[model samples]
Target: MSKNKKLDIDLLVDGLTCIDNYSNDGFVNIPTDKSALHPARYFKELFMSELIKDGVSDEDIVAELDLSDQNFEEFLNEKAMVTSLLAQRLCVVTDMPAAFWLRAQSRFDDFHTRVE
Candidate 1:
């Protein structure tokens, strides 16, 4: 079974007026929040550094992760959440822990939910 982890948002963006303030390389450094990383940007940075920059093709990731073409594309666009199974599969493919992905997804969700 997956771990029943406790989730919390300990630090918030200190003075973020716009999303433009955050760069895409992940981990927005908030003045008040200190150096806490934003989960969505963190994932994007991880994917780029670990996969895209390493010449891991999108199709290769789809096949290796056992994702359908559509699902893979959607994942790229952040149109879908990473299912628990997909998180585990990602751990195999990317060496990132499934728990880490789950936590990132939770944080990402919270951020977007607040945005909406």
Candidate 2:
């Protein structure tokens, strides 16, 4: 990943923890205006990217995730919420800590501000 992209992920993760206290609910209850720092979309994106990198086709990913194309797109767009199960799937597939997404979000936000 590019440096900026990595920073964005870090910011996203940190923001998730900071805003929601890293609750186990899998939903970050941030205000709509604060959505940029939310981890849902970030997690989904990372999950999808990893799956793709692992040679999983988009169709297969959608099927495995039990999501329709439109729904998947909506989730990617941050217009739909993801369940805790989906988060767990991401963590499992990426071999990343379950809390990694939240921390990445936070670090991304912090890095962006520092650079700007």
Tens digits of per-residue lDDT, candidate 1, 17-73, equal 433233343223233323334434444554544576778776777788898998876
TM-score of each: 0.58, 0.45
lDDT of each: 0.56, 0.52
lDDT of 2 by residue, 25-47 (tens): 44333322243444555655555
Candidate 2 Cα outliers beyond 4 Å, as residue runs:
1-8, 11-36, 85-116
Q: What are the C-alpha RMSDs, in order, of all predicted structures?
A: 9.2, 9.6
Model 1 whole-model lDDT (C-alpha atoms): 0.56
Clashes of each: 0, 23
* Model 1 pairs in collision: none
